[model samples]
Target chain A: MTLDALIQRLRDFADARDWNPDHTPKNLVMALAGETGELTALFQWLTPDQSRQAMGDPHLRERVLDEIADVLLYLTRLADVLGVDLLAAANAKIDRNELRFPARQA
Target chain B: MTLDALIQRLRDFADARDWNPDHTPKNLVMALAGETGELTALFQWLTPDQSRQAMGDPHLRERVLDEIADVLLYLTRLADVLGVDLLAAANAKIDRNELRFPARQA
Candidate 1:
Protein backbone atom coordinates (compact mmCIF):
# COMPACT_ATOMS: atom_id res chain seq x y z
CA MET A 1 0.00 0.00 0.00
CA THR A 2 1.05 3.58 -0.53
CA LEU A 3 2.11 5.77 2.37
CA ASP A 4 -1.05 7.84 1.95
CA ALA A 5 -3.22 4.76 2.27
CA LEU A 6 -1.48 3.77 5.47
CA ILE A 7 -1.92 7.29 6.81
CA GLN A 8 -5.63 7.12 6.09
CA ARG A 9 -5.88 3.80 7.87
CA LEU A 10 -4.15 5.37 10.85
CA ARG A 11 -6.60 8.27 10.69
CA ASP A 12 -9.53 5.93 10.65
CA PHE A 13 -8.06 3.98 13.49
CA ALA A 14 -7.62 7.14 15.54
CA ASP A 15 -11.09 8.45 14.71
CA ALA A 16 -12.62 5.21 15.76
CA ARG A 17 -10.93 5.50 19.13
CA ASP A 18 -11.55 9.24 19.50
CA TRP A 19 -7.80 9.69 19.57
CA ASN A 20 -7.66 12.69 17.28
CA PRO A 21 -7.45 15.19 20.11
CA ASP A 22 -4.36 13.45 21.36
CA HIS A 23 -2.77 12.82 17.99
CA THR A 24 -1.45 16.32 17.48
CA PRO A 25 1.90 16.76 15.74
CA LYS A 26 3.71 17.39 18.99
CA ASN A 27 2.19 14.42 20.72
CA LEU A 28 2.92 12.23 17.74
CA VAL A 29 6.50 13.45 17.72
CA MET A 30 6.88 12.60 21.35
CA ALA A 31 5.35 9.20 20.78
CA LEU A 32 7.66 8.63 17.87
CA ALA A 33 10.62 9.38 20.11
CA GLY A 34 9.35 6.97 22.73
CA GLU A 35 8.90 4.22 20.18
CA THR A 36 12.39 4.84 18.87
CA GLY A 37 13.68 4.35 22.38
CA GLU A 38 11.87 1.03 22.61
CA LEU A 39 13.36 -0.05 19.31
CA THR A 40 16.81 0.85 20.56
CA ALA A 41 16.28 -0.94 23.84
CA LEU A 42 15.97 -4.27 22.07
CA PHE A 43 19.54 -4.08 20.88
CA GLN A 44 20.99 -2.62 24.07
CA TRP A 45 24.07 -4.43 25.39
CA LEU A 46 24.51 -6.43 22.21
CA THR A 47 27.81 -6.43 20.37
CA PRO A 48 27.70 -5.32 16.74
CA ASP A 49 27.96 -8.94 15.65
CA GLN A 50 25.21 -9.98 18.06
CA SER A 51 22.99 -7.15 16.89
CA ARG A 52 23.50 -8.15 13.26
CA GLN A 53 22.66 -11.74 14.12
CA ALA A 54 19.67 -10.71 16.27
CA MET A 55 17.16 -11.70 13.63
CA GLY A 56 18.58 -15.19 13.53
CA ASP A 57 16.80 -15.87 16.79
CA PRO A 58 13.14 -16.24 15.87
CA HIS A 59 11.71 -14.82 19.09
CA LEU A 60 14.13 -11.94 19.19
CA ARG A 61 13.46 -11.19 15.54
CA GLU A 62 9.74 -10.97 16.14
CA ARG A 63 10.29 -8.47 18.95
CA VAL A 64 12.65 -6.42 16.86
CA LEU A 65 10.26 -6.30 13.90
CA ASP A 66 7.43 -5.19 16.17
CA GLU A 67 9.55 -2.30 17.41
CA ILE A 68 10.42 -1.39 13.85
CA ALA A 69 6.74 -1.36 12.96
CA ASP A 70 5.94 0.80 15.96
CA VAL A 71 8.58 3.37 14.99
CA LEU A 72 7.34 3.59 11.39
CA LEU A 73 3.70 3.85 12.40
CA TYR A 74 4.41 6.66 14.82
CA LEU A 75 6.56 8.42 12.19
CA THR A 76 3.84 8.14 9.56
CA ARG A 77 1.31 9.52 12.02
CA LEU A 78 3.60 12.37 13.02
CA ALA A 79 4.07 13.31 9.36
CA ASP A 80 0.34 13.21 8.83
CA VAL A 81 -0.28 15.51 11.77
CA LEU A 82 2.36 17.96 10.54
CA GLY A 83 1.15 17.78 6.92
CA VAL A 84 4.56 16.54 5.89
CA ASP A 85 4.73 14.13 3.02
CA LEU A 86 7.10 11.52 4.41
CA LEU A 87 8.04 10.09 1.04
CA ALA A 88 8.74 13.51 -0.38
CA ALA A 89 10.73 14.54 2.67
CA ALA A 90 12.74 11.33 2.51
CA ASN A 91 13.47 11.89 -1.17
CA ALA A 92 14.52 15.45 -0.59
CA LYS A 93 16.78 14.34 2.22
CA ILE A 94 18.51 11.92 -0.13
CA ASP A 95 19.07 14.66 -2.66
CA ARG A 96 20.75 16.82 -0.01
CA ASN A 97 22.75 13.88 1.29
CA GLU A 98 23.99 13.19 -2.22
CA LEU A 99 25.41 16.69 -2.38
CA ARG A 100 26.95 16.43 1.08
CA PHE A 101 28.40 12.97 0.56
CA PRO A 102 28.83 12.77 -3.18
CA ALA A 103 29.71 9.32 -4.43
CA ARG A 104 32.52 10.51 -6.68
CA GLN A 105 34.02 12.80 -4.03
CA ALA A 106 33.47 10.48 -1.08
CA MET B 1 10.10 10.63 -4.73
CA THR B 2 9.33 7.00 -4.17
CA LEU B 3 10.87 4.97 -1.35
CA ASP B 4 12.69 2.92 -3.97
CA ALA B 5 14.35 6.02 -5.34
CA LEU B 6 15.62 6.99 -1.89
CA ILE B 7 16.91 3.46 -1.31
CA GLN B 8 18.81 3.63 -4.58
CA ARG B 9 20.39 6.91 -3.53
CA LEU B 10 21.44 5.38 -0.23
CA ARG B 11 22.95 2.42 -2.05
CA ASP B 12 24.80 4.77 -4.34
CA PHE B 13 26.04 6.80 -1.39
CA ALA B 14 27.37 3.71 0.32
CA ASP B 15 29.03 2.53 -2.85
CA ALA B 16 30.71 5.91 -3.30
CA ARG B 17 32.18 5.76 0.18
CA ASP B 18 33.20 2.12 -0.29
CA TRP B 19 31.07 1.54 2.82
CA ASN B 20 29.19 -1.47 1.44
CA PRO B 21 31.27 -4.00 3.33
CA ASP B 22 30.54 -2.11 6.55
CA HIS B 23 26.85 -1.74 5.72
CA THR B 24 25.89 -5.35 6.29
CA PRO B 25 22.47 -6.10 7.74
CA LYS B 26 23.83 -6.57 11.26
CA ASN B 27 25.82 -3.36 11.05
CA LEU B 28 22.84 -1.49 9.62
CA VAL B 29 20.60 -2.77 12.40
CA MET B 30 23.13 -1.74 14.99
CA ALA B 31 23.49 1.66 13.39
CA LEU B 32 19.72 2.03 13.31
CA ALA B 33 19.54 1.23 17.00
CA GLY B 34 22.21 3.80 17.76
CA GLU B 35 20.42 6.47 15.78
CA THR B 36 17.21 5.69 17.62
CA GLY B 37 19.05 6.23 20.87
CA GLU B 38 20.21 9.62 19.68
CA LEU B 39 16.63 10.50 18.79
CA THR B 40 15.45 9.44 22.21
CA ALA B 41 18.20 11.33 23.97
CA LEU B 42 16.78 14.59 22.66
CA PHE B 43 13.61 14.02 24.64
CA GLN B 44 15.22 12.54 27.72
CA TRP B 45 14.38 15.26 30.24
CA LEU B 46 11.35 16.78 28.64
CA THR B 47 7.93 16.35 30.12
CA PRO B 48 5.08 15.49 27.78
CA ASP B 49 4.27 19.16 27.40
CA GLN B 50 7.88 20.11 26.81
CA SER B 51 8.27 17.30 24.33
CA ARG B 52 5.23 18.44 22.39
CA GLN B 53 6.58 21.97 22.32
CA ALA B 54 10.09 20.82 21.47
CA MET B 55 9.88 21.95 17.89
CA GLY B 56 8.97 25.46 18.94
CA ASP B 57 12.60 25.89 19.88
CA PRO B 58 14.15 26.20 16.45
CA HIS B 59 17.46 24.61 17.29
CA LEU B 60 15.86 21.73 19.13
CA ARG B 61 13.43 21.14 16.32
CA GLU B 62 16.22 21.02 13.78
CA ARG B 63 18.01 18.50 15.92
CA VAL B 64 14.86 16.44 16.21
CA LEU B 65 14.20 16.45 12.48
CA ASP B 66 17.77 15.40 11.79
CA GLU B 67 17.38 12.48 14.17
CA ILE B 68 14.17 11.51 12.49
CA ALA B 69 15.89 11.53 9.14
CA ASP B 70 18.74 9.48 10.51
CA VAL B 71 16.36 6.84 11.92
CA LEU B 72 14.52 6.60 8.61
CA LEU B 73 17.64 6.43 6.44
CA TYR B 74 19.03 3.58 8.53
CA LEU B 75 15.70 1.77 8.46
CA THR B 76 15.50 2.07 4.71
CA ARG B 77 19.02 0.71 4.35
CA LEU B 78 18.33 -2.13 6.75
CA ALA B 79 15.21 -3.10 4.82
CA ASP B 80 17.19 -3.07 1.60
CA VAL B 81 19.75 -5.47 3.03
CA LEU B 82 17.09 -7.74 4.53
CA GLY B 83 14.98 -7.82 1.36
CA VAL B 84 12.06 -6.32 3.26
CA ASP B 85 9.54 -4.08 1.53
CA LEU B 86 9.05 -1.42 4.19
CA LEU B 87 5.72 -0.26 2.80
CA ALA B 88 4.38 -3.79 2.64
CA ALA B 89 5.60 -4.57 6.13
CA ALA B 90 4.10 -1.34 7.50
CA ASN B 91 0.75 -2.11 5.87
CA ALA B 92 0.75 -5.63 7.21
CA LYS B 93 1.58 -4.31 10.65
CA ILE B 94 -1.36 -1.91 10.59
CA ASP B 95 -3.61 -4.83 9.71
CA ARG B 96 -2.37 -6.74 12.72
CA ASN B 97 -2.62 -3.69 14.98
CA GLU B 98 -6.20 -3.17 13.87
CA LEU B 99 -6.99 -6.65 15.03
CA ARG B 100 -5.12 -6.15 18.28
CA PHE B 101 -6.45 -2.65 18.98
CA PRO B 102 -9.83 -2.66 17.30
CA ALA B 103 -11.51 0.71 17.18
CA ARG B 104 -14.65 -0.55 18.82
CA GLN B 105 -12.75 -1.96 21.76
CA ALA B 106 -9.98 0.60 21.93
Candidate 2:
Protein backbone atom coordinates (compact mmCIF):
# COMPACT_ATOMS: atom_id res chain seq x y z
CA MET A 1 0.00 0.00 0.00
CA THR A 2 1.14 3.48 -0.78
CA LEU A 3 0.92 6.51 1.44
CA ASP A 4 -1.94 7.66 -0.74
CA ALA A 5 -3.80 4.46 0.07
CA LEU A 6 -3.12 4.90 3.78
CA ILE A 7 -4.40 8.46 3.61
CA GLN A 8 -7.55 7.26 1.89
CA ARG A 9 -8.09 4.60 4.57
CA LEU A 10 -7.73 7.24 7.28
CA ARG A 11 -10.25 9.44 5.49
CA ASP A 12 -12.67 6.53 5.32
CA PHE A 13 -12.16 5.74 8.99
CA ALA A 14 -12.87 9.32 9.96
CA ASP A 15 -15.84 9.61 7.64
CA ALA A 16 -17.30 6.37 8.95
CA ARG A 17 -17.10 7.67 12.50
CA ASP A 18 -18.18 11.19 11.53
CA TRP A 19 -14.89 12.41 12.91
CA ASN A 20 -13.94 14.54 9.92
CA PRO A 21 -14.72 17.78 11.62
CA ASP A 22 -12.78 16.85 14.69
CA HIS A 23 -9.81 15.48 12.79
CA THR A 24 -8.32 18.89 12.30
CA PRO A 25 -4.54 19.27 12.16
CA LYS A 26 -4.25 20.40 15.75
CA ASN A 27 -6.49 17.65 17.04
CA LEU A 28 -4.64 15.07 15.03
CA VAL A 29 -1.31 16.33 16.28
CA MET A 30 -2.55 16.17 19.84
CA ALA A 31 -3.77 12.65 19.28
CA LEU A 32 -0.46 11.70 17.78
CA ALA A 33 1.31 13.07 20.82
CA GLY A 34 -1.00 11.16 23.11
CA GLU A 35 -0.36 7.92 21.29
CA THR A 36 3.36 8.53 21.45
CA GLY A 37 3.06 8.90 25.20
CA GLU A 38 1.24 5.60 25.41
CA LEU A 39 3.91 3.88 23.38
CA THR A 40 6.53 5.21 25.77
CA ALA A 41 4.57 4.21 28.84
CA LEU A 42 4.90 0.59 27.79
CA PHE A 43 8.59 0.78 28.55
CA GLN A 44 8.57 3.39 31.30
CA TRP A 45 10.05 1.24 34.04
CA LEU A 46 12.45 -0.84 31.96
CA THR A 47 16.19 -0.29 32.05
CA PRO A 48 17.73 0.63 28.71
CA ASP A 49 18.82 -2.99 28.19
CA GLN A 50 15.44 -4.24 29.23
CA SER A 51 13.82 -1.89 26.78
CA ARG A 52 16.11 -3.23 24.06
CA GLN A 53 14.77 -6.68 24.68
CA ALA A 54 11.16 -5.58 25.08
CA MET A 55 9.96 -7.10 21.82
CA GLY A 56 11.17 -10.47 22.99
CA ASP A 57 7.91 -10.75 24.85
CA PRO A 58 5.16 -11.51 22.40
CA HIS A 59 2.42 -9.67 24.26
CA LEU A 60 4.59 -6.63 24.86
CA ARG A 61 5.66 -6.59 21.23
CA GLU A 62 2.05 -6.73 20.12
CA ARG A 63 1.17 -3.81 22.35
CA VAL A 64 4.14 -1.83 21.17
CA LEU A 65 3.23 -2.42 17.53
CA ASP A 66 -0.34 -1.34 18.19
CA GLU A 67 0.78 1.90 19.78
CA ILE A 68 3.16 2.46 16.89
CA ALA A 69 0.29 1.93 14.49
CA ASP A 70 -1.78 4.47 16.37
CA VAL A 71 1.00 7.04 16.22
CA LEU A 72 1.51 6.46 12.50
CA LEU A 73 -2.19 6.71 11.75
CA TYR A 74 -2.57 10.00 13.60
CA LEU A 75 0.61 11.36 12.09
CA THR A 76 -0.46 10.51 8.57
CA ARG A 77 -3.88 11.98 9.17
CA LEU A 78 -2.42 15.19 10.54
CA ALA A 79 -0.11 15.51 7.56
CA ASP A 80 -2.94 14.78 5.13
CA VAL A 81 -5.21 17.42 6.64
CA LEU A 82 -2.40 19.96 6.55
CA GLY A 83 -1.48 18.97 2.95
CA VAL A 84 1.97 17.90 4.03
CA ASP A 85 3.48 14.93 2.19
CA LEU A 86 5.06 12.99 5.03
CA LEU A 87 7.69 11.31 2.89
CA ALA A 88 8.69 14.57 1.29
CA ALA A 89 8.68 16.41 4.56
CA ALA A 90 10.84 13.70 6.09
CA ASN A 91 13.25 13.99 3.18
CA ALA A 92 13.42 17.75 3.47
CA LYS A 93 14.06 17.51 7.18
CA ILE A 94 17.02 15.26 6.48
CA ASP A 95 18.41 17.83 4.06
CA ARG A 96 18.18 20.52 6.69
CA ASN A 97 19.91 18.32 9.24
CA GLU A 98 22.71 17.59 6.81
CA LEU A 99 23.60 21.27 6.95
CA ARG A 100 23.00 21.79 10.67
CA PHE A 101 24.99 18.74 11.80
CA PRO A 102 27.38 17.77 9.12
CA ALA A 103 28.27 14.13 9.63
CA ARG A 104 31.86 14.45 8.42
CA GLN A 105 32.47 17.59 10.45
CA ALA A 106 30.81 16.18 13.53
CA MET B 1 17.45 13.71 1.35
CA THR B 2 16.34 10.15 1.35
CA LEU B 3 15.45 7.99 4.36
CA ASP B 4 18.86 6.39 3.94
CA ALA B 5 20.47 9.81 4.32
CA LEU B 6 18.49 10.50 7.42
CA ILE B 7 19.56 7.17 8.82
CA GLN B 8 23.16 8.02 8.09
CA ARG B 9 22.80 11.37 9.76
CA LEU B 10 21.37 9.70 12.83
CA ARG B 11 24.30 7.32 12.86
CA ASP B 12 26.64 10.26 12.61
CA PHE B 13 24.86 12.12 15.37
CA ALA B 14 25.16 9.16 17.65
CA ASP B 15 28.73 8.48 16.67
CA ALA B 16 29.76 12.08 17.19
CA ARG B 17 28.30 12.09 20.67
CA ASP B 18 29.66 8.61 21.44
CA TRP B 19 26.06 7.56 21.98
CA ASN B 20 26.17 4.51 19.74
CA PRO B 21 26.56 2.19 22.70
CA ASP B 22 23.49 3.75 24.23
CA HIS B 23 21.54 3.90 20.98
CA THR B 24 20.25 0.39 21.40
CA PRO B 25 16.78 -0.15 19.99
CA LYS B 26 15.35 0.01 23.50
CA ASN B 27 17.12 3.25 24.34
CA LEU B 28 16.01 4.80 21.06
CA VAL B 29 12.44 3.71 21.66
CA MET B 30 12.54 5.11 25.19
CA ALA B 31 13.89 8.39 23.90
CA LEU B 32 11.20 8.44 21.27
CA ALA B 33 8.59 7.91 23.94
CA GLY B 34 10.06 10.67 26.10
CA GLU B 35 9.97 13.05 23.17
CA THR B 36 6.40 12.07 22.46
CA GLY B 37 5.48 12.85 26.05
CA GLU B 38 7.03 16.28 25.73
CA LEU B 39 5.17 16.83 22.49
CA THR B 40 1.84 15.89 24.10
CA ALA B 41 2.54 18.01 27.16
CA LEU B 42 2.64 21.05 24.93
CA PHE B 43 -1.07 20.72 24.29
CA GLN B 44 -2.20 18.73 27.33
CA TRP B 45 -4.65 21.30 28.65
CA LEU B 46 -5.78 22.66 25.30
CA THR B 47 -9.22 21.81 24.02
CA PRO B 48 -9.38 20.22 20.58
CA ASP B 49 -10.07 23.63 19.07
CA GLN B 50 -7.18 25.18 20.93
CA SER B 51 -4.94 22.35 19.81
CA ARG B 52 -5.94 23.03 16.24
CA GLN B 53 -4.86 26.62 16.71
CA ALA B 54 -1.66 25.68 18.53
CA MET B 55 0.74 26.53 15.72
CA GLY B 56 -0.66 30.02 15.43
CA ASP B 57 1.66 31.02 18.23
CA PRO B 58 5.11 31.31 16.69
CA HIS B 59 6.92 30.10 19.79
CA LEU B 60 4.56 27.18 20.21
CA ARG B 61 4.86 26.27 16.57
CA GLU B 62 8.64 26.26 16.78
CA ARG B 63 8.58 24.04 19.82
CA VAL B 64 6.08 21.70 18.22
CA LEU B 65 8.19 21.36 15.10
CA ASP B 66 11.27 20.71 17.19
CA GLU B 67 9.51 17.95 19.07
CA ILE B 68 8.22 16.49 15.83
CA ALA B 69 11.73 16.42 14.42
CA ASP B 70 12.94 14.73 17.55
CA VAL B 71 10.22 12.09 17.35
CA LEU B 72 10.84 11.41 13.68
CA LEU B 73 14.57 11.17 14.25
CA TYR B 74 14.12 8.70 17.05
CA LEU B 75 11.51 6.71 15.15
CA THR B 76 13.73 6.39 12.13
CA ARG B 77 16.67 5.42 14.30
CA LEU B 78 14.65 2.79 16.11
CA ALA B 79 13.55 1.33 12.82
CA ASP B 80 17.09 1.32 11.53
CA VAL B 81 18.53 -0.53 14.52
CA LEU B 82 15.77 -3.08 14.31
CA GLY B 83 16.42 -3.63 10.58
CA VAL B 84 13.00 -2.40 9.63
CA ASP B 85 12.44 -0.12 6.70
CA LEU B 86 10.31 2.67 8.05
CA LEU B 87 8.63 3.40 4.72
CA ALA B 88 8.05 -0.23 3.88
CA ALA B 89 6.75 -1.04 7.34
CA ALA B 90 4.41 1.93 7.11
CA ASN B 91 3.13 0.70 3.80
CA ALA B 92 2.63 -2.81 5.10
CA LYS B 93 0.72 -1.46 8.07
CA ILE B 94 -1.63 0.45 5.78
CA ASP B 95 -2.22 -2.70 3.77
CA ARG B 96 -3.22 -4.55 6.91
CA ASN B 97 -5.44 -1.68 7.99
CA GLU B 98 -7.18 -1.76 4.65
CA LEU B 99 -8.32 -5.31 5.38
CA ARG B 100 -9.28 -4.57 8.98
CA PHE B 101 -11.16 -1.37 8.22
CA PRO B 102 -12.44 -1.59 4.73
CA ALA B 103 -13.12 1.90 3.49
CA ARG B 104 -16.28 1.14 1.50
CA GLN B 105 -17.59 -1.26 4.12
CA ALA B 106 -16.91 1.17 6.89
* Candidate 1: regions farther than 4 A off: A104-106, B24-67
**TM-score list, all predictions:** 0.78, 0.72
Instruction: Give the per-residue Cα lDDT of candidate 2 at A42.
Output: 85
- The complex in candidate 2 yields a DockQ of 0.34
Residue A29 in model 1: shift from native, Å? 2.1
Write down the lDDT that model 1 would get: 0.74
- DockQ in order: 0.38, 0.34
Model 1 Cα interface RMS deviation (Å): 3.4
| Chain B TM, every candidate | 0.94, 0.92
| lDDT of candidate 1 at residue B26, scale 0 to 100 | 60
Q: Write the per-residue lDDT of candidate 2 for residues A1-106, one digit (tens) a residue.
A: 4557778867877787677898876577678877877877887888878877877888987677666767777777876775556566565565676678656432
Tens digits of per-residue lDDT for model 1, B1-106? 6677778878878888888778766677667767766867877788756766777788986776776777789888877765667777787788898778778743
| B1-106 per-residue lDDT for model 2 (tens digits) | 4557778867767677676788876677778777777877777788777777777788986666666666777887876776556556566666676678665532
What clash pairs does model 1 have? A52-B26
